[model samples]
Target: MASSVSAAAKASAAFAHKKELAAAAPAPTQHRAGSGRRSKPCRVRAVASPARAPRAPSSTGSVKTAMTMTEKILARASERAGLEPGENVWVDVDVLMTHDVCGPGTIGIFKKEFGGDAKVWDREKVVIIPDHYIFTSDERANRNVDILRDFCMEQNIKYFYDIKDLSNFKANPDYKGVCHVALAQEGHCRPGEVLLGTDSHTCNAGAFGQFATGIGNTDAGFVLGTGKALLKVPPTIRFVLDGEMPPYLLAKDLILQIIGEISVSGATYKSMEFVGSTVESLNMEERMTLCNMVIEAGGKNGVVPADETTFKYLEGKTSVDYEPVYSDAQARFFSDYRFDVSKLEPVVAKPHSPDNRALARECKDVKIDRVYIGSCTGGKTEDFLAAAKVFLASGKKVKVPTFLVPATQKVWMDLYSLPVPGSGGKTCSQIFEEAGCDTPASPSCGACLGGPRDTYARMNEPMVCVSTTNRNFPGRMGHKEGQIYLASPYTAAASALTGYVTDPRDFLM
Candidate 1:
């Protein structure tokens, strides 16, 4: 890794410290997550049955006559009645996904709770993806997959992405990406659908305009036997991001700022309905990044209203016909906040918490030892494209050790062949390889969780890193001593190049 910045960058003083700018500012929102507001029981709107509740006119302020995305999707899944906030209804699940880390435990609970002879509620709806900890050298990890595989065979579950890809990396075309991405790839996640997964990031699928959320093992076991889950319609909090993001800004930054503003638990148990032109402008991948982190804000789910971009991503990629639901104009929000995207700076969540954030430029000089640029949160073609653009401009390699994960095999295939924006005849992986970095072929959730011993990029030594992956909770990526700073893929790349935390704008042309 290079030890110094390019001559052009040194002269720019992009990392110059400004104490005033670094100071944390008073929050600009009313419901800031951990801002010491008096704890209050979740605001429960009075329960109303579908028969009694009528669709409100667009101009009406009555929530009873309106429906938020969560209410609409849950009501349909209920199949028996309409749903409103605070109403606990048994909603049928469209799909249920579990990865290796949680699958074995979930299966155990299923058998213990439903009896040994009971089979999965619907074999076709259960999708298994052995991702987290699958690559570990531990026999226990491999055995977990064996357990899942055996169960799938016995139950006739077909939507299973096994450890097939680990053999040749490109061996299995059926080995979809991460559980969340694979779900979307296979069309299991769709607008107006209700999906559940053991992964908290399952909310990532909510970008498709669905009511997707994470569940615990007990809930998974229950759903396994019944294909139904009990969920109270969550009140929706709308974030209307206005204005256009600057060229250097990305969705990761926008989300970090939101979490930073709201505190990690700011939106606890509420549906985050992201609306605004800026949100509409984000591509499907970016929108997914937005929803993926809502859990960080203590949200029940995160969603963007399905639009052209959402459909364009699913067109031809999925055979499942889907219905798209939109929040009624009269849908009432628990609380609303508007942020001008153009005014938002690239932000990073500091160590130990997702909401302990600050402007990336303000912390530009903080030295880093590691950089990671892939995870379900930041690993995508668009994310790699942003990183490649920065690397191409610097005409340099990374100064710190960096890892590039492609989120899935399909994404890796694209990076393996994608030409760097301006680099002469070089692929994305080639650019990183040339910069004295490593690009692993097989993609899975690596280091995002401090996985088993054999997990690649697992932090063994105490080192500071700027990563594109979500969450910075202590020990989230690896060793508890290893501090993590969360930023955009662009920031990850820029920081890798400079050996210090950096604002991507420093390298943007």
Candidate 2:
């Protein structure tokens, strides 16, 4: 019995000794594993939660008391309050937009990488719009649409706005006109959110004070699998446009002039924030037009802070709870420039590049073969009305074959009762119908992409085309031999009347 007790005492003492040694150990295995080799180890913590963390300092020496529009959106997306420009952060994506042009390729890569049966990160976050090549009779285009339709069906995504929604709105209650417009109008793009689209003009949604930009198919495929994207917070260039009223000039003229002055690469990879009395004077549709062409200027995005116009547009359209973000009064900017719109004149982008611009009246002698008055940049009801006033004032037939493609079905629907800008005797719908302008059945990207079976007005022969679309690059409108001139809808209508590039003011007087 004494021997048994002694053995038990020895075993208990050994265990107590082990406990002391463990308590006196230098550190845990994990804590000391890489500390001996390298001080900084790639240790990953738990997956990032949506709860915001403490804000880091801004790139500038100033401690940012308030965030800019871009900063707020990115910070919130990355689950942090403060973000410095040029720092790459992993951001949660609010919307992943894929159109017919890039949706198939994105889907192909997504399936190949994630496996066919692998589910998307967030099915409802994926938005598919088959607008780029839908009007074609080509089998491949149809197949592309079918792929998107099938994928959305399999994923049970509710945001896929397909061709049926183009005409039969009842078929899909979530129909929108264009991807950019649909994004905002349908409440997908909210302030303080991150929205990425497959097309460059995705910047258009930035008009609502959101962080919206374009990504290629590979990046989109990754976002499809994981609802996250690495973003380098972009520095913003603030443009202050304080000016008196100008009769002839519109938002298109202002943007054209800005592009001409900045060159296409001036704001490369940077955000262009439009501010001042002029931009504030614009309505939501006009602000969208201003932001849509930022891609042409090589900007990461173009934004206008949330204002009354923006607030009103989103009021009834969005039921999604969202916090509105704006640039602090003392927001830090990479560069700042001011322009007086009162001194600005009507402008047009010459052939080859969007930055190659000239005053509209200066290029009046330049002849045109066709006039296109539609695209995301110039398809709104306001654009149509602005153009209609010129046609009504002329009371003349269109000298050139003009094409009017409304930006969205809603814009098209509103056109039935559009008044001429000056409240002239006739409606815009009547003016276009009487002017021999060809109107497509539904609103779409149309000829913006110059896809196969090319929609309405494409260059069949080498000709000078004055268009209201955003870009004017070589072969942008289907013909390398064809030259394109970009202008406002008002300017385009005046040019269509004279069969040459003319200033709308000349006709207005």
Candidate 3:
């Protein structure tokens, strides 16, 4: 453990030295011609100095303070030497993302406050993605996208992922579905940066070791007029998850367990930092799943410190240089909790609340009418792979109707292109077809947000559904009386096969 901590300190120092050298060098003059836009120069900020040993004395004869990853990132973004919880600071925004659901309202506020002729603080910093309300006949929903497109064109926003053809998603090459997934896929989520989005799930990017959180339309408008936001530094709750994860469990199950332990309002306005061996073993997608539902616990943000796994995932995704930060060995926390993941089992959130948790095996008698496997939380490539693994193991058709919606166009393509690890070269598409599940729909936030009356696979009647979505509240998926059970992809697939809330262990073991 001591050796590992020393290695981390050395790595952080090396990154700081590299950043300093890069700052002193001349800027490159290359343009992203493929996207018809010029790449922006890396903006240098005050880099946090390498942390000292726990309780070590400083040159001034005072004990140096230890900072958490969240605090260090905020300090750099706010251009401060150090910061503590509850301190209000003005942080420079690295990325400001807005989607169709909140874009129109944010734009309205921007125009009303900054004037119609006033230009945005930075065109390239703003990302407008039209994910929700697409693939629907709702005139108002269609109008929302038009409003976003007009605004992007007027502002010359370079990162607008627009979808024009509602009939077929393939016709729109620039379209990327689901803003959170699209943000990470398109290289907007860099380590040690500050990202504020109009949607609550923006915290998903925290998996990349960044400070990401949601903002209201008014806050977004302020960010549009000025590339800065005044935010309070949040006290962080440390969660240490040790031991190897069980085969029947996934990141979704782990997060559900945490939320269940602490309730929905437990982490209100607090940063939730996940660490330990279990987290380090998770892939980038699994780490994303862990951070995606922090908002469900009313957390201000969720973060996993960047490591080689994070750097590897960002290698081809982003061209921008970034320096990752880590929490000091003695970093202070508001509270701490520890869990042994190997001893845990599959769990789910019952209807009416996200924190209403129960063991999947205990709820085996609960009959489900349908199953859904989609949304930013559970619709990534790994998610579908996990589901297909269950179906492949069971070797049986689903008793209930199963719906699959990939979160993004890239994820959709991956479903068809990538092969399941041990399925005799069979892909997720083939497995879904063999299981008699519905054909994978075009990538979007389909049925997750209950967009319209005609939404594909939406529950219009009072039906019980076992879903991989984050929320299980009444009417979260469709009808107010409809019951939704939030579970892991593995559990959802197993339940679909039996038409009951079944535990994945029944098949995996």
Please report the candidate that would top TM-score against the real structure: 3
lDDT (tens digit, per residue) of candidate 3 on 1-509 = 01111111122110121211011121111111122111432332343334444544665565445567788889889988678888999999999999999999999999999998989999989999999889889999999999999999999999999998889998899999989999999989987799999999999999988999999999999999999999988877777787889899999999998887777877788888888889989998999999999988888999998767777777678877676666655567776666788888899999978889899999999999999999999999999999999999999999999999999999999999999989999999999999989999988888886778988889999999999988878788889999999999999999999999999999999
Q: What is the TM-score of each candidate against the true structure?
A: 0.87, 0.85, 0.90
What lDDT does the true structure give each of the candidates?
0.78, 0.76, 0.85
Residue-by-residue lDDT tens digits, candidate 1, 1-509: 11111211111111121111121122112211111221331221222322333444344545444566688788778863345677889988999999898999999999999998899988888999987766666888889988998989889997988764455657776676677777776677777788999999999999988999999999999999999998878877777787887989899998898887777777787888887878878998898899999999888999887766776677666666566666655556666666778877788998989988888888877999999888889887788888888887787888888888778887888888878766887888777777767765468888888788678888878899999999888788878889999999888888999999999888894
Better of 1 and 3 by TM-score: 3
Candidates 1 and 3, the one with greater lDDT: 3
lDDT tens per residue, model 2, 69-160: 78767888887757777889999998899988899999999999999997888988898887776666677887998999999999888788
Candidate 2 stretches greater than 4 Å from native: 1-66, 164-175, 421-425
Specify the poorest-scoring 10-residue window by lDDT in model 2.
Answer: 19-28
Give candidate 3's whole-model lDDT. 0.85
What ranking of all candidate models by lDDT puts the best one first? 3, 1, 2
The Cα RMSD of model 3 versus the native structure comes to 8.9
Number of colliding residue pairs in each model: 3, 0, 0
